[model samples]
Target: MDVNTTTGLSAASALTGVEVVERKGAGHPDTLADGVAEAISRAYSRYCLKEFGANLHHNTDKTSLLGGAADVRFGHGELTAPIQVLVNGRITAALGDHTIPVADIVTTAARDYLARALPLLDTPRWVDVRPRLTQASSPGAVNAPDTAEREASRQRWFAPRSLDDLAERHRMFSNDSSAGVAYWPLGIGEQLAVGIEAHLTGEAFRTEHPYYGTDIKVMVVRHGVRVQLTACVPQIARETPDLDTYIARRAQARNLIAELAGTIAPEHHVTVCVNTRDVDTRPELYLTATGSSIESGDEGVVGRGNRANGLISMFRPWSAEGVSGKNPVYHVGKLYNLAAAEAARRLHEETGLDCAVALVSQSGRDLTDPWQAIVQTSGPNAILASRARRVIADVMEDLGTLREQLLDGKLATA
Candidate 1:
């Protein structure tokens, strides 16, 4: 393992100047894709682990949703065309002669996830789950001569005959060459960006304002001491009586969010704007039968929304690796991103300094031991550097247990 610990990270200091952060709610199309893909992976993993005692090789991170046509109005709406969800990925469908019901599992998971994500929509009537799973190897894969060592690789590459063929049962290895990055102590803009969306889409807010939809987007932009928050909150057509009621409800929601922002970042001057594209004369507003824009042809794909941390911070560095549907056992893309954030938070708490952690993993490398780890602190301090190393090492050692948390839905991918 190679670890580089440094201090005096001045460029990563105070959250001054202009910063932008955004968050997509659970019902957003992209987030819906992420949730559906992750649900399928978790379901498949649970079935395999219980049936075969090990999670086989699989990566279902390529799920996407195509928007459907709808005739929405102020009080009632109907989906004119069904939304199609393309579930594309690779999975171990058969173990020797025994076949796994991959299609049933994927379809069930997608439908159940969509039902929960969009409560107002009739999932069976308006949504279609299409599974596109395969067990084929990559084009670059080479078939070596039949040998003792090569036999095991061939069995477990996509289909495992038994636990003996699974190398991860003995040692976890990276599945790809990827990087994960994280920073501790979120800025005010970041806090508001994530907080506003959470508050709007939360259960308490939903109960109080049943008209508000789950498909909400919050963008926070901060320059100097002033902050501007723009939020697009969907209103359920059935719950909302008319345009007058919608306008009043929008105002009330906006006021509440502005108050919440004030409480979240008291030092900054925050202004809240809801549904900026709305026009009173045209009577055009963000209204829908389902709280999500997917009802009206808003296409969404995985990896296009928030990161694993749930906030898209434009001012900070991030990785392109999407963590939603990758295998939790050996997929460093998911494990390392969660670990990096955990390590950064722990380092900041222990050292009282803004810290950033970047982990790079090479394909087939040890899961806990990355190819390189760089730790940067806010200021120069030898003591802090040593502590960061210890904290990072401890966090890496616990990477194996993240699978359980992810399975339990403790980590938010979006």
Candidate 2:
């Protein structure tokens, strides 16, 4: 419950020198890993709720994607080897005699997620999904009431050890401890970077530019009023008819992004470059069969991708916690990150001051009560500080609302 606030440089003022921001498109390998992990967790939670009336204890946060080799040519490409997708983690797999199809569910979730995220990737033909999930059941864990009664009718149920045991079981199955971090009121440069990236990946934009792949990367650097954006966008071989067409499309996309950046900050001079590594002299380009680097030996692991805000900012403080796939209820890693971001945004809105919020939570502690909560703002007024404290307190007190938002997919960590 400890809360503190102090005057400091705003996120925008702090960027007196070079400010850099990076965002990974949804189809990047690391993003793909995050997507699959979250998909499995959501799928598993839904299954558990329907079958057991509660979300079973599970953490599928160790998902990974190993890039595969491909022989990519102009307008065509062939996978030399299938991308190896490994979904690893633990989950409750049994309620008495009824065994849960954990592997089947996870694998299907992974495939479906990748298919949607990377539409050009032939998931069934180029992606090999391997489920390494293992059962996670405590010795004194109690089954759901319906499951217990069903087993009892079959003469296979066991009595609870004690009232304390039942309480402990309930607490253990309720949620996991995790933390989340967020910040708001993005600076002009950061906003431009994120906006441009989102615009390129947006469905409407992609529909017009069918060759544009999901594995897009946008990096923005701002020095004073000059903003530079470098985008690495892959083009699907099938959609792009030839090298010349790809070049034309890339130019069109770059110009569109530059125009969008100008709209984001009209005072800033903007420059946009797409696929800097491409060399037309050698006829080399950023081409892919699946529009993702996963088909070309770029490995991805959970937590290595974007943060809750969807962009990595070098000028901002960020936690190393990975929020996806963790239990949405009590996982401090996920909760604190989301809470921190919300706190910052709300504080800024109330006080009209740029703010940064950080929160820490201990294991087994109520998520609403954090070990420490810090709020820093560019404003030195005591009224702003007092308002920031009140905002933080209000956010911490409403943990249940945050939980619902998380479960409803309103908060994204990848």
Candidate 3:
């Protein structure tokens, strides 16, 4: 990728060709779905001058104890909000049981996730995602209200019917998918807050029907954008939440794909965030990292000519540059170097396009583990020989027509 004279930014030419990458949760802290969402949404507003921005609110004070086999707890359910985890219970103990406290778990997760995602969000320089904390009582009340719907049980507790009743709330929305999004919001209230924030900021793009009642509609007009960010709640709410590993790996892959795809050369890349209710069985559409052997550095930036595998082989300097001393081939990874590329190519040959694609990409943070591609198309074409091949395919076909119209026209000058 070409760098600007002094800023060292990826030049316009670097945008040519495609780059496929994978980032796991272990490596990137902000890859957490919630964090990524918040970053994009916030960037839509205040980060206009910065690369990224973020805001978090935790109100576990409104804990709820359901009765009769239904134990639902909605304390500051946004415990996982970026950078702010309310410690409802003192942490005199360890991680298990009452040791870590529900609040601590969320706080730790937010801190850890932000560490990695902040870089991708470009929050420091070209990007910014500032995090703000709303002032609250040092230790808010147990805020638990029983919603048993009985006059007897209702007597002792104050339940929250609307987000306002809760001690904390956060909101975000965006028409620009490239913009960052909000990361935490355990219930509808937080989602509403995100939406409200976007609306109030005058940055949340309103929506119209693309098909008909399809929640998957996108609209970006003026200096605004709005997207209904969904959550993999069931998985996220399992007995034990282990999203860090999954998120970082996903980050590595996403970075690789976006970088490589953008390399298609003035091809007008399109990014689609296909959220899944089932992260385990349903792989995200654009979430998979596959294509060519060439790899990217920390923020999806790649070296020159490192990706010479497939269709990208047709493009000049399709991937990110390898470090000065490292073997360029080795830098791209064994998968892209030979075997994986061959396997990826074979699928396209047999199916004319990779119907069930494998997510391919090497992660510098961990060599032994390479992220697999999810079976979904970022675009139409398949034979992703290099960064160029993959991105061109997606931009030409993957981006919905309406979306293309919006970006090409509505946001073209914007």
C-alpha positional error of residue 298 in candidate 2 after TM-score superposition, expressed in Å: 1.4
Alpha-carbon runs more than 4 Å astray in model 3: 1-33, 36-101, 119-263, 266-350, 354-414
Give TM-scores for every candidate, taking all chains together and pairing residue i with residue i.
0.95, 0.88, 0.17
Q: Rank the candidates by lDDT, best first.
A: 1, 2, 3
For model 1, residues 347-384, the per-residue Cα lDDT tens digits are 88987888789989998888888898888877666334
Cα lDDT tens digits for candidate 3, 35-68: 3222222222122113211111222211111111
Better of 1 and 3 by TM-score: 1
| Alpha carbon lDDT at 215, candidate 2 | 87
Identify the leading candidate in terms of TM-score. 1
Residue ranges of candidate 1 with Cα displaced over 4 Å: 8-15, 147-150, 382-385
Estimate candidate 1's RMSD in Å: 1.9
**What lDDT does candidate 3 reach at residue 190?**
23
lDDT of 1: 0.84
List per-prediction Cα lDDT, in the order shown. 0.84, 0.75, 0.24
Error of 1 at 123 (Å): 1.1
